[model samples]
Target: MKLRQLASECDEGPCPTVWTIDEDAEHVLVQGFKVEDEEALATMKMPEHETTVRTPMALLKRVAREHLT
Candidate 1:
């Protein structure tokens, strides 16, 4: 399976991570900064692994659907 890019990162280090989506929208890879420190943010290239969350898109849709009704 191939994953597609839904979002992009900053030009340099310690930027908001990119969001990605697959063809079926079943899986989602969310990324971003873990901490908010002026000095540390400047030196980091990406968000910490613990900060990112990968989940199923279908589950999200289902929850939304249920909530709407």
Candidate 2:
């Protein structure tokens, strides 16, 4: 997706928030924001990471299987 479109969808929650993405001719930039306690923020600066995972549907299936009888 376009960078602006991706960035606009970010929101605050129990998870990290995506802030913005700047797409360049050679590379794409990813930015994010997160809420944290003062101590955590002081030590870590921003609690964002460069990681990815499977879709929520796949995650849900895994969780359900783990808890199933």
Candidate 3:
């Protein structure tokens, strides 16, 4: 349960890998995962305020921005 910054670059939908977005849909949680695997694990979620990512990084960097707060 951590906040992960996404790369500005994306390959579009049906990508080989997938990102796990938060409940707010405002940020990424982890890098990428196989599509099949992602669905199976999507049931688990972290409480909003308690969410945290190890090796902390900035979430507002322009390289990867999440505007949905």
Q: Scored by CA lDDT, what does every candidate get? A: 0.48, 0.38, 0.39
Q: What does candidate 2's lDDT look like per residue over 1-69, in tens digits?
A: 455322222255433222224545444333334334566566655535633322334434433454333
| CA deviation > 4 Å runs, candidate 2 | 1-22, 25-33, 45-69
**Residue 1 displacement in candidate 2 (angstroms):** 12
Q: Output the better candidate (2/3) by TM-score.
A: 2
Among these predictions, the greatest lDDT belongs to: 1
Poorest 10 consecutive residues of model 2 by lDDT? Answer: 8-17
TM-scores for all predictions: 0.29, 0.23, 0.19
Candidate 1 stretches greater than 4 Å from native: 12-14, 23-27, 35-69
lDDT of 1 by residue, 25-65 (tens): 65555554345565655565555453433345554454455
> Over the full model, what C-alpha lDDT does candidate 3 score relative to the true structure?
0.39
lDDT of 3 by residue, 8-64 (tens): 234565322224455556544443332343343455454445432222244224334
* Candidates by lDDT, descending order: 1, 3, 2
- The superposed Cα distance between candidate 1 and the true structure at residue 55, in angstroms, equals 16
Candidate 3: residue 59 lDDT (0-100)? 28
Q: Which candidate has the highest TM-score of all?
A: 1
